[model samples]
Target chain A: MNPMIAAFLVLAGLTCASALAMAWTKNLLHAALAMFLCMLGLAGLYVMAYADVMAVAHLLIYVGGVLILILFGIMLTQNSRADQYETHNDLWTKQSGRFWALSISLSVFLGILFILNRSMSSFGMVSNEIQRSTKLTHVGLALLTEYSFAFELAGVFLLIALVGATYIAKHHE
Target chain B: MNDIPLSYFLIVSALLFSIGLSIMLLKRNMIFVLMGIELMLNAANLNLIAFSRQDDQIQGLVFSVFVLVIGVCEMSVALAIILQIYRHFKNIDLGAEKSRF
Candidate 1:
């Protein structure tokens, strides 16, 4: 009814639809595009959840960083062949048996739903705390003060991971 | 935005998580499976952000940041491993040589 709820609904639709599309499509490129849209919608959802800072960070990381890396993976691992139909090699991927995949995942989803429905009464068990404003100052202060050690460790881990990735990907035996 | 209930977000996240799981189960390409993993991770992140809206300590947000960092590391390392696998076998399909694994 209201704009806020409307926005939430729209973003949620976008995210879920794109995610479904990504799963449904066999074309790898189409899936990548769908993933892009999915990430964009997720950022909007974060905004709806009042985590604007998290939204921005997510947009930057997923869209700008992870996507490009995925594209690189798709490009690098493609099996090149001289056949006529081989051009689809990079764009398309094979699927495992569909029926079991669907049935298993659907059952798991139903189980999760059942659990969530049972737990709805328990959210009230926790003390509902005051909501914070959508400002970066508090986050910045906390990252620097309370979370400084973890932040530094994350940076170091990122560096090590990148370096290790490069070393592992090199043209060596 | 303020009027939105937490259950709605939870439902959406659950839906996404399920879809990603199916994708992971169904896809043969290693890259496609990786994409599914990313989708599931994003769904978990959304849940954290949604619940953290009502949290005072902002722990969920911080934890999600670390999650993001870890995701990036995983993607990089996995891709590198994939590249190596491609060089060795000329194919990146999961379980291509099932008897070996």
Candidate 2:
């Protein structure tokens, strides 16, 4: 058992477990906490894949930016109609049912696994070029040179989205 | 030069995507649904990064970066829309009550 595989197993376990916890819990806050753990585990998995840049960026964006946005959405939207307790804020949510959701997800996962198994040999095209160099250098240069247009487009799109979000969220009375 | 089999990553990615799909299907809260969508997006990005591991060009890595940016954009916009929906119906549950969406 190589240490790398061991670490990957641990991180994948953490990611999947927290994701399941998020799916199982009805409380909004608990789900948010579970999402936090899931994202952290995902960042770990990215690092294991030698995507240090993507891992750090993912950690920053999901943990710092998106999570805060989600928390704000939680706070701003609680109706307070079912005020079970003062401190709790009535964060419990509802689900349609367990049977369909569970069955559908299981089926989808198994189907994907079967397909991946069938197509396994096709992915071997990259087997011979297993470069272990840090991807940060290549990613940076490519984003600036070959992908400069797309890179700028992403920035502009982000600006537009933020502006549009603020406008949409404003009090429109 | 650690050589972790790619199948492990794919399996993990599949599991994450399935759990996220279940969450999206099961949860009624708009925020919970959004989180589920985020999870699915991350799972796809994981596949991209994993596939790019052995490639020298790192095309998947760059694509994943753009995906991350787009995911953030979607999150912000969706959260804002959810906020407005909350104001309209005074609740965020998609199917919890008489509301349908």
Candidate 3:
């Protein structure tokens, strides 16, 4: 087996296993830990896909930014008992009926598989040549040139979202 | 370097999306549901990156970047809303009882 395929398999396994762990756990903190591992594995998969920029950005945004936000959300929302000290956090979370969730997801997966199989032949390769060159420069240039307007819009949108989020989270009393 | 088929990526993403769907459906906690939404978004992003490999213009990559931005925006706003809901109800469970109040 080629090393590249081997690496891809390993990364995909890590990603999927951690994702499953996240789904299986009832503890919220355990789920958060699983999500961290899942995100790390996904970043590795992005690297294997030659998306180094995306890998780094994903690590930074999901790991650094989003995960922290989630952790904070968990902390701020919890109720404290009289006997509890700061050493521990109540992390157990409730879950609904597993039957419906499992059946729906399984059916969705099967449907997607059927569609992919039927349409496999229609997706002809656009180019046989693979560009192994680093996409950083190309992505930057394109974002500045062809996609400049959208790029600026995303930036402005991000600012608005952050400000709005802060406003929404404030004490309204 | 491109030995991997696009189908493999699609299959992985499909699996991810399914797991995410299940998470969203199964978890009663609001934060857990948000995590599921993030997983679904990431699965879609993975598909975009994989398909971008075949395109000379790499349009899919650029689109995925915007998707990432929008996803972050969604996360922040959703979490904030969840925070307010928790304050109002004193619980974040999706199916909390109104009789308790």
Interface RMSD for all numbered candidates: 1.2, 0.9, 1.0
lDDT of 3 by residue, A17-124 (tens): 999998999889989999999999999988877788999999999999999999999989886667777576448898999999999999999999999999998777
For candidate 1, write residues A16-83 as lDDT tens digits: 99999999999998999999999999999998888899999999999999999998888887777677
Q: State residue B8's C-alpha deviation in candidate 1, in Å.
A: 0.7
TM (chain A), candidate 1 = 0.92
lDDT of 3 by residue, B1-101 (tens): 44687888899999999999999999999899999999999999999998887777878899999999999999999999989988888888888793142
Steric clash pairs (candidate 2)? none
Model 3, residue B5: displacement in angstroms? 1.2
Model 1 per-residue lDDT at A114: 96
In candidate 2, stretches whose alpha carbon ends up further than 4 angstroms from where it belongs are A81-85, B96-98
Per-residue accuracy of model 2 over B1-101 as CA lDDT, tens digit each: 46788999999999999999999999888899899999999999999999898877889999999999999999999999988888888877886564567
Query: On a 0 to 1 TM-score scale, where does candidate 3 land against the true structure?
Result: 0.96
Per-model TM-score of chain A alone? 0.92, 0.94, 0.95
Model 3 docking grade: medium
Model 1 lDDT at residue A153? 98
